[model samples]
Target: MIRPFAALLALAALFSAPVLAAPAADAAATPSWSIAIHGGAGTLQRKNMTAEEEKAYRAALAAALDAGAKVLAEGGEALDAVEAAIVLLEDDPRFNAGRGAVFTWEGTNELDASIMDGRTRAAGAVAGVTTVRNPIRLARSVMDDGRHVFLSGAGAERFASQRGLEPAGPEWFATERRRRQLETMKAERVGALDVEFKFGTVGAVARDQAGHLAAGTSTGGMTGKRWGRIGDAPVIGAGTWADDRSCAVSATGWGEFFIRAGVAQAICDRVRLAGEGVQQAADTVIGEVAAMGGDGGVIVVSAEGETVYSFNTAGMYRGRADSTGTREVAIFAGD
Candidate 1:
């Protein structure tokens, strides 16, 4: 009943109408900046520690958290936040780094530290450096220098000097408590030192407002360590790793086992390729390490700000802070 011209007009109108393509899939929202830290993990027992000792430890952890949290709150890079937090711990005589570093078999301090940037995958590390005031700061210098990922022994000290990092004398690193502990270990004449002495390495992981992640670890190595021993704390994939695609990790535990397990990288791989959550990945890895006769713990932060503190030991000194003003510090295993 319709004329041919009318039919042609109807078709033209139908074709002329704009068609909306299906809306593009919504992108995932970036996470708010967050930070997490660990003093160390070992056979810590509440009954074994005095009230005064516990208070001192808790206060130290809080101060470290504040240092990193301040950086995150002010929109600073995650790398700087981690560095700031570690510097404070390194300066404090309470922890087994810097001023309170444990003595080696030769009765001297050998420091180790590493730092990583998730955005660029850049990393820096130093091992067996005796005189650097803050090994974490020197590690950052090595990272920013862009020439090498690791430097060790006298070479690291030379690099520190070249970078103008201040050097501290041997006396600056020897604390009376650490000296007494070393003496006790020597008296025991045991093949392995007590696990209690092993828990003192300090580490931090952070996510910035820009969605970047960074991780760092610093330690005085192990008490009575011999032959220039180096632990996972100075090893990139073992003690520290950060990647924008997955997560940032800082580990403190048995360095030998952590190195074998590639703890940091393993955690990220689980998150990146297996679609596992941060906590699951960390827990699984820690369990595996425990099964292998290693004890320790790790702090992890995903790109989206999810965090996990996983350890097989009795306790780990840890804390967390986020953009929402949430902050917590804990030391006991149940806590």
Candidate 2:
């Protein structure tokens, strides 16, 4: 039999065990998985948006953030999280990626998307793909198929069919808002420049609990685009890039300037080789794009669990969430 003092000591030790181990257990459970996402970046001003419109956008952004956060919290991979978020945005009519995609000058919807895995540097993209329900999925199929890194036009659609991807007719993707925008742009004779249409694209970047990184971008090309133009969204190093040694990046902006500046890869290169922090790299690269007379923004997740957002536009539709208890969803420059 134990004495009263000894019994109290034993109980004390038992209670103290969890308390002593709490820090390690908590640290293990919270692996600093983080994510950042963007709908687009361009001439979005708060005054231009009605309260109802702003609320709708915020709801959509929050929903996407929750989707990706659920994946990360449930121990899913970064690639899955990125894809899940973009897939939701693609289906939503409010953004300019899939169902709500802008029409070309010919009034057809041609989607483009790209995905990258930092683990193996495996990347895939599809440009000018019509009839793909979700271009992001098609891009992933390309990566998983391993036969090619990029596919375009009817060929990509054929590959999508062969891979059993969901299909949609061109009309299914054409929304009245986008058609009106196309008509307006045509009346104005606007070109493929992103300035005409608010730089509308959707993208995500994530660092998972397993320490893997991934990035993806999807777009409807540009309003009034002609000749089967493909934006940076389908260009791996331009709009989407991921590397475990540095970070994952997804950009929305002027595709030509992003391609010329190598925006995505340059950010990672600065982080990996120049030892710059993720935010610094993002800011520097985006600044260069601005200096080159382009406007846009980026969402990034570094392998070290840093998340960043950098843009040179009036507004960017963006959100972020992480294991560290950070959560945000915002639009407009000051938000």
Candidate 3:
């Protein structure tokens, strides 16, 4: 047997030695930081989109990724990064959150958004707000205010004003495309869609260098929603959830099913408690939504920095970027 002094010296050296380099592939598999975002999920088909339309969409997604990545690279909080990405998407009229929001049955715009911080498990949401420039920012403000988890209608707007949040006129949200969609719904004389629902929610999820996770989602609700309708986007556990113990999730699709299924929290429960991978948890949850006669998608980022996207629709406008120089943006199923 070795002498005790020699054994002690050996142990010291072993402990002080430099760490071995991980394999390149393994290192790449796990980035120092990661972010993922989605514009919406629906019956998106290549044939229905023009080449220019596809190009514009890809560019918009890429821009959102850039905004979020810049923050994470500078060691920003995941909550801020998520808000940054979503703000860009909200301003882009191609998506259905802020500027391009769909119209209510009464021919007006109503916006909804929610944000969660995994480190503290704090969240805030606003629904049926008409004039916030970016609902995601208002959501962040609400979360920071330390009171109330959800706010709605004129009350939410008053809270926004009190917080000095940016305000926009209703006309700022009235896009030509949204008007056309509202007209289509009215001409068809259908109160709501049975099969032609385009789930137009925009969202982001991210993990920062500090290991904090955050998620945020913003939406204009459905094309012809009525009676001050609110979708999953503004419901914390349904459309958005973040917990340091699990992952951060932002969901888009049929809000009713998502609210009933509690999609975001469901994904987190499977991952946090059951030791399931992020993608596996997301897939299982999305599959259940489909079985329930609803279809949509979610983007999730785990505490361990794993990014996942799961959807049951034909396509979801999605993108991801990480510290490892990996960049991806796609709208099709396989892409």
Candidate closest to the true structure, highest lDDT: 3
Model 1, TM vs. native: 0.90
Provide the clashing-pair count of each candidate structure: 0, 0, 0
Span of ten consecutive residues with least summed lDDT in model 1: 15-24
The lDDT for every candidate, in the order shown, is 0.85, 0.85, 0.86
Instruction: Assess candidate 3 and give its lDDT.
Output: 0.86
Poorest 10 consecutive residues of model 2 by lDDT?
Answer: 16-25
- lDDT by residue (5-123, candidate 2, tens digit) is 44423322321210000112133344468888999977678888899999999999999999998999899999999999999999998999988999887888889999999999999
* Per-model C-alpha RMSD: 19.3, 16.8, 15.4
Runs off by more than 4 Å, candidate 3: 1-28, 190-197
Per residue, candidate 1 scores C-alpha lDDT tens digits across 140-172 of 999999999999989999999988999999999
Structural similarity to truth (TM-score) of each candidate: 0.90, 0.89, 0.90
Which is better, 1 or 3, measured by TM-score? 3
Candidate 3 — which pairs collide?
none
State in Å the error of residue 245, model 3. 1.2
The residue pairs found clashing in candidate 2 are none
